[model samples]
Target: MHDDAHAAGVTRAGAAFAARRAELRMTVQDVVDSGALSKSALVNFENGRTWPRDGNRDKLERLVGLEEGALTSLYEQGAGMSRQDQTEGLVRAGAAFAKRRDDLNITQVEVAEQKIMSVQALIAFEKGRSWPREMRRAELERLVRWPPGTLASLRNAAATPSPDLDGVSAEPPADPSTLMLDAVKLALTSALDKLKALPADDAPTFIAEARPVMASLRSLQALASRAVRANIGSVSAVQTLEDITACFEDLMGRVAAHPAASLGQKLYVARRKRHLNVQEVADILDMPATTVAAVEADEQELSDDYRERVEQLIRTLTFLKL
Candidate 1:
């Protein structure tokens, strides 16, 4: 399958090269004289006798004012298969990525937002209509919750046939606990905010107010733990949920960790890490937008109680699952 496709690509590329050169009224010698390619190599390529190597192919593309890989795309198209088909491993990997995202109920818009790509570009990459650049691919891998280069391994398998799929499941079971991790984190952060708002001297009032929040956290943790024991998902995910549950349990009675060297720096980092702009954070916290900005800029003095509350929120944000 691979060889047949490759041969077709070479023949098609050769014909395309010849046609484009003719359209431009350029001769074989004219190409060679321009230092784009050698006489023998140019003849072989134009005659469909041989394919050009990387360097020569690049030169040919430049000679014709074609973008890099434009000729290769033509080759792929003429081969009667997509670049995705020729690279089944990549297809499989992409399928796995899609399945994982679906399992999490994560939207493509969310993935694109986190990956910092346009929605159309992310959609094209996911559909195998186009490939992403290296850094972008890495970002996508992270967004999909895979280890780095897990999908990149597909590139190495491009020349081979697809692996067996009958024994493998495309949409494997995912840890149900993992699905709730983000929600739990946000809930815990909200709880911390409420706790921070109470007067430090009012222990009874704090406990009374905190009881419902703690109960909710305990319930979520129990659910997550039950999912793990039931083997409802990946072991790694189960372990992660368990670990985070334990961390939150420990944090329930603990005070917030120290802020950054400055209050403003801490505020800035916390908001950015949560991907919230100042106005959004203000809206959520019920603070004025100008006050949020002023606090972040260190231009306005905040009361000690308000500053402490913000610090607790910042510490809670630190525990956020990214």
Candidate 2:
């Protein structure tokens, strides 16, 4: 218990340095630019449970205005440890920042409304003392960017402004078949974005997630591609569009209903940790770029060669993560 208290106090000082320095009107970007350190490196230092030394302290002091004794105390308290431990300060800072918002003189409701989070949740986050994880800190970090900040992204989610689904009826017949088209189109767009964002080393996990969904998407693409190739009459094209939509609902149903979701989640976790790119996996299998469309839907049957390629991609990811 004594040791835990000591560790918490050390952690708290690191937290205090970040909170106080920023309170003194210094911005993180200011520190990053002046110190010529990568934003992440500075983030790591300010977020450390202990302070960084070996000249980093000098740079930080120049940015935030700390005296020698204060710097030494903070550094000794928070400097060396696991990244997970270091990152906790960011979480703690986020929570602490929220707690003090009232002293900064803002109402919880206003903060919640601004951040697109429930007031209750805002309360929980500020009060919760459990370990902080990346996802949890992400929103908090965004909020802390502005003194008494809020996340625009979360607010935007709330303001998602309904899309014009009326146009959807023109392309697909209004029925259960319509669902398939909708799901496929959504997944297709998602996969394309993922491919564009990730590189080879960053692709495997995404590919694994897409592997099952991709197959179905490809089959749809193949069918859609075939429709264009067949030169179906303009009038008949409407029916083709409707047929495509049917295929979409049929495929998504399977993907969402069963083991597919579990598999995709496992793959997503692997991809996130390994930083693997699905595009690389597709290339390895000699798949075309259109394959990106298929992956998000998990539509591919995966030829034996492709399956082996996927296995190799997974192996590569495991090694990278290590």
Candidate 3:
């Protein structure tokens, strides 16, 4: 019965993935060509016959533009009682809290205004998408007129099953560097999403925001490259970093062609590309830091004197090959 339930969950997740692929207008061949998975594996995955291992799972998620863990969360819904059961238990607990609040004629807004949490966060908790943090859990219990240990007790009851009890070996903790790389990937994905949302008419604002993200990506790429050269990380980590760099460069090229990007924005992006800080460029230009900042902000007309200084700074940056 448990195995059948697990198969059903996997099938549901597979159906979702297949639907997303169709929505994106991608073919199974396209996914195979991208090397995210082989044809047979892709067929099996989309047919709900199997789950991809972690590394392939990450690659597949990236290829489909899904948020990290989108598929895994679905697969967990039926793989075992450990996660799914715990989730359902916690959800029930949240519903009970909601009922209690309703019985008292209290609004979610009223509870949030008392500083227990924001309305969105309270809503997430009530919906069982997440639990309140430890520091806030007690306050939440009190706000809902529950006993002091009520929240903690609920959380404990919903915790993952012990390995000893389940006869399943516990997974080892993740490497610190691997965890950091995962975070970088998430940040890059978020930046890419934000970049896509910017209107073409707002080129100045877009470039201003994008340049910082570009700088951060370059820094992370350098670090990851060094790690790869030193054989300090896994093959998957190296590949993930390379994928992030490619995504960043692709978006940058699209943004770079925007005709409405101002001269100030152009120079600001160039300065960032050269890895020069604003203060450093200001010192070289013999101008105040505020003046450099003003130019980059593109908020006012530049005086002839200021314009000449800016032009000179640009020439210097170019000549130095920086």
Candidate 4:
């Protein structure tokens, strides 16, 4: 899965590198000479063979001059030699990173020279197979800025287990709560806009990420609404979150209710939050011009081709300036 993501990111990097190479009109030999690395190594790198290394990064940077950027991160992550494991306590392979250092489990110093501490630890630690001590846990955690639950896991590697979506994204989620809200918002907006055209992959991915947030919001909403009914709290404190929950729910409903949106509408929502002209939208939906006009003006009842699309368009575009 991480490999899939790495592949996707590296695909982007390959394009970037090729574009830079073309822009500079520098051939394989130019990089070999400029980077002072082996010609075969340079060729292999350009041809997607060699992995990006810290030692070689400076030379590459000097050679390419980073027109927009190099694919260093993706390049390194993709390389088998630099393969990171269990990034930030998200164990790469459970057995691989559970190495014991004496009575305590710690091996960061051994791989301290590596760029990603968590990955290095997992790779080396997995090679050992034992639990780390509390102090070692704290040190490694602070050393890597691990997630909230990892301290306990480090203390008793026997207890805490990694979870799905744990290392799904290596980037620390800005906020778990915020992440959920944003995922829901993203799914809703994406669904409303892309509709059936939404990649089967993307829609599900968004929903999976956002489900936790949505569930949490619903639970909170229920609790708060009950609280309001119970008179356990004042209106001011819970009021803000309560209002936000309502808006979030309503937004989710609109998105889920109609899953088949048009390309124009989706692009519009993504860009200007404005609907295209009736004819353009009609082209997107493969509907009649008159149907589009009637749908847009709300004269026609929402139906198969236009039903969800028009309403979604209105929802996204009605208040938007563009």
TM-score of each: 0.27, 0.30, 0.29, 0.22
**Cα lDDT of all candidates, in order?**
0.58, 0.46, 0.63, 0.43
lDDT for model 1 comes to 0.58
Error of 1 at 275 (Å): 22
Clashes of 3: 0
Local accuracy of candidate 2 as per-residue lDDT tens digits, 1-322: 3554445434544455555443432335445545535567666544444436548766665444356566556434433333455445335544556655655666778656553366776666565443333223333443344431232122112222356777666564554334444543554565456434533323435434433333434334543443444543544445554655554444334333334353333333445455556555446556543342233323334566755665565556657736
lDDT of 1 by residue, 1-322 (tens): 4877776566457656765554333445447655677878876675446777788788888665467987777666546655455456346656666778798887888865553478887666566565564345545655666644555444323433355677687787665455555444554465457545654433434433443443444444544554465556656547645664654444343312222134654666677768789878777666555466556534466788777878787888888899
Name the weakest run of 10 consecutive residues (lDDT summed) in model 4: 80-89
Give lDDT tens digits, candidate 4, residues 1-322.
Answer: 4665555334334434543443333434345534446766654454444455656755665444452234564344333222233242224223423433322545555434332245554555454443343223333443444432243333223222347665588665564444434433443343334333433433645443333334334334433444454444555425644564655445444434335533332333332233355557657656555444333222345555456665565566555664
Which of the numbered candidates is closest to the native, going by highest lDDT? 3
RMSD of each: 21.4, 21.3, 15.5, 21.5
- Tens-place lDDT digits, model 3, residues 208-228: 555545544544565455446
The runs of at least 3 residues in candidate 2 whose Cα sits more than 4 Å from the true structure, single-residue gaps closed, are 1-10, 75-109, 130-322
For residue 1, what is the lDDT in candidate 2?
30
Write out the backbone clash pairs for model 1: none
Q: How well does model 2 score by local distance difference test?
A: 0.46
Return the lDDT, model 4, position 88.
Answer: 28
TM-score of 2: 0.30
